[model samples]
Target: MSCCGPTRRTLLGAMAVATLSSALGAGASRAQRNSLIATDLELVTVTDRSVIMTWTTVAPDASGQPVPVASSGAVRVAPVGSAPVTMYESAEPTPFHYAEITGLEPGRRYIFEAESEGVRAVSALNPVTLAPDAPEVCGEFTTLVPPPGRLLRTFALGNDVHYGETVSGLIVGDFPPGFRSLPDLPPYPEVMLAALLDDLRAPDRGAQRLILAGDLTAEATPSQSRSVRAQLDSWGALGRDYLVARGNHDRPHTGADYASCAPATADHRDCFTEFFVPREELVQHEIGGLRLLGLDTSELDGTGGRIDRPQFDHLTGILTADPDRPTLIFGHHPVTRTSGATALAGPGFILNASDSTELQTLYTRAPGVFLHHAGHTHRNLRTRPDTPCDVEFLEVASVKEYPGGYTLLRIHEGGYMVSFYKTRTPAARQWSALTRNEYFGLIPAYTLGHLTDRNHVVHRDFSGLT
Candidate 1:
C-alpha cells in the first residue's frame, strides 16, 4: 500500500491545501450572511434606579416584518467599575425597540452595547449614570441636597415630538390649501431635540435630564416611531436622560381594523410599550430632598387624556407610600385649566372643562404631588397655583412645530425655578414664524402666544411646598 502512485509526503501536502480551501470558503459564507441592521439605538433616560434604552431596525425582513433587536447590539451596560455585562434580549418582530434596565446603582457609570445581528456595531459604553447623581462623562455632578440650600441645575422638558407628519391638516378641521407640509419644516423634531440637548450641554451649566412628557409621534407608524427614537438617541449621546410618557398619539387608533395601525407582526401595544414605558414607573429620584415621580398618564384607547381608575388609584398609593418626599409629577396631559376652559379638551382641543375638574380633584387629594409637568399643548403656559395642595402646572412646548421649544425646571433648597427655552436655530425660528403666520387668525385669543414670544413668562416661585 505504501508503494502506491504518490509518495506519502505528496499526499499529505494535497490534503493540507484542501483543508485550507474549505476553511476559507466557510469564512466567506459566514461573512455573506445577512446582518441585523441596527437603527434608533439610544439610551433614552437614566434615573437613580433605572436606565431607558430604545432602537429600531434599518429595514424590514423578508417577511416584510420590522426586525426586532434588543439591547444586544453594539452597546453593553456595565457598572462604573464592574465587568459583568448585563444581557438584554428582545422578543421578536421589532421595528422600534425600547428597554428599561433597572436595579442600577446611583451615580455609577454604566456601559452598554448596541449590536446588530450578533455583530457589535456601536457602543454606548460608560455612556450613562443613574440620576440623583451627577454624570462622570463630562465630569462629576454634585448630588442635590435638601433645604437651606444646594444649587439645582436647570433641565428642559419636551413632548409630542410627532415626527413624519404634515402639521398643516392637524390644526383645526382642515389643511390650508397653500400651506406647506410639516415634513418640510426645518429643525424637525429630531433636529430640535439635537439643538435642545446642545443647549443643555452648553458650558458653565449642569443640565441633568430632558423630560419628554409624551406623544412622541404623530401616529405609531414604524417610520414615525423610528424617527422619534433616533432623535432621542441623539440626545442620549450628550449624556441626557429623556423621561418619557405615553400620549394619545402614542397608542393605536381604532379606525378600520386596529391591526392596520399596528406593527403587522407584533401586538398593537408593542410599538408603544417597546419605545415608551421605562423598566419601572413610579421612579423616585432625589434632587436635594425633593423627589421626582414620573407617572404614566397616556392610557389605552377609550381612556385618552384621562387617567384611568387604576392609574388614579396607583397615584394615590404612591403618594401615600411616600408622603414626606417633595415630589414632581410628569405626564402627557395637564391636570388643571389655564382659564375656564379645560387643559385637555378631548382629542382635537386642549383640555375640556369636565376633564380638567376630574383630574384636578384627583391630584388635589394626592400627597407629595407638588409640581405637575405636562406637554400635550404646543403652547407654553403656566397655570395659577392650586390652593390647599399648592401644585404648579407647567405645560411644556412641542418640539416638531411652531414656537418649538422646551421648559427648564430648576430645583433648589428654597423652592424651584421654571423657564421656557426656545430653540433658537434658524429652522426653529422659521417654523415659529410660519406657525404664527398661518395660525394667527385661528390662534386661541386667550392662551399665551408663541412660546418664543417676549411675553412668554418664566413663572417663578418658592411659596409652593417643595
Candidate 2:
C-alpha cells in the first residue's frame, strides 16, 4: 500500500475541510456525532528497521455513506517494554493516513496504536468496545532479519498495467458497477504507469532493470500497445533495459480496432506481437550471469493459459542446456494450483491445472531456476508449490489500482530479497487511495498481503553472478 506524499496529504486535507464543513452544516438538522472515527487500519509493510501503517478517518453522514474527515493522524509505536515514539503526518489534516515508523530493531516485536483527532482506530483484529481504559493495541509485528550478503543489483518487477481500460474489478459475466477514475482526474492507468516509472527512476530505488510480467494493455488494440510502448520507451531501451511478457488481455482479437495490426500466429490480429515480439517467439536474456526467461502464457480468446508444445520444448532445451545458470522465469498467468483460494478470477485465472503440473515437474529438473514472477491476480502473494523444486511463485499486485506499485528484487552475493514499493508520486498515491474502495471495499483484504509476503529474503549462493 502507498504512503501519501506531502502534496497528496495537502490535497486530501483541503478536500476533508470542504467535506467536514458541509457535513456540519447539514448535521444541525440531523442527529450525528461530531467526533472522528478511524477505521480500516492496516499494517501495510514491516522490514528490519521500519514499519508502515495506513487507515482512514470518516464523519458520519445522514446518507449513510461516511464523509472523509480531515484530522491529524498519528501512530504510537514501541517495543514490548520500551517508551513509545509518536510519528505524525504533516500538519495538514487528511482523511487518509500513512505513517512510517523507522529506526526499529530487527527481530524484535513491536506494538502500535493509530489515532486521529484523539479517536482511536479500529482494525480487523480490534473491535469497538466501550471501555475507556483499553490497552491501545491496534496491532503488533516482529521485524525480520536483514537479508545476508552484499546487495548486487536491484530490478523492478511489475505487471497488470491495463492501459486503455477505464474501469476496474469488472469480472466477465459479473457486470456490476466497477471502480472508475475520478471524473475530474486523468485516466488512472496513465497516472499510475507514469508514477511507477518515476519511482523507479529515483536513485534511491536502485532499479537497474525493469520487467513487466503481463497485461500491458486492456484489449491489445494497436493504439493501446503503441501507447504503452511509448511510455516504456521514455524510461529505458527495450530488450536491453526492460522486457515484457504477453498477458491474456494482450491476446489476439478479431475486430476492426485491430484490423490494421500484423497477422498473429493465431487467426486474429495481435498488436502485442506486432510490436514486442514480431517473431512471436519465447524470450531469453543473459544478464551478468543471470538468465531471464519470458514465457507467452496467453491463450487465444481465453483467459486461461497452456504452454504450447513448441514453447514448452524451447524452455526445456534452454534449461537443459544450462541447468545451473541461476534463472528466473516470468509470465502473465501463475501456476493455478499454487495460487491458492484468493484468486479472484476463479479457477481459470491462471495456467490450466495440467500445464501447472507439467511446469512444476520441469522446475524440478532445473535446479538453477529460483523464481517465477506472474501478475494476473492483481494481489501480492508468495507461494511455493508442493513439489520438491526449490522455487518461489511470486505474484505481484497491479500497477493501475489499489496498492499501486511494483516489487523490487534485490540480488546479493549470498542471497536475494524481494520487497514491494508503492509508487510515491502525489498523483499516483491519490489514485491509489481512491481505488482502495474497489471490490465492494474488500480490495485491501485481498491485495495488501502480510508483511512477510510483501518483504522477505531468501538464502542462496548468488556469489556466482557479477
Clash pairs for candidate 2: none
Off by over 4 Å in 2: 1-33, 61-64, 124-138, 340-342
lDDT of 1 by residue, 315-368 (tens): 667777766556777777665544325433444344444555655665566655
lDDT tens digits, residue span 340-391, model 2: 4558777787888888888889899999999999998898899978588999
TM-score result, candidate 1? 0.56
- Considering summed lDDT, which 10 consecutive residues are worst modelled in model 2? 125-134
Cα displacement (angstroms), candidate 1, residue 170, comes to 3.2
Residue ranges of candidate 1 with Cα displaced over 4 Å: 1-149, 176-187, 237-240, 254-270, 278-288, 299-304, 339-367, 385-387, 440-466
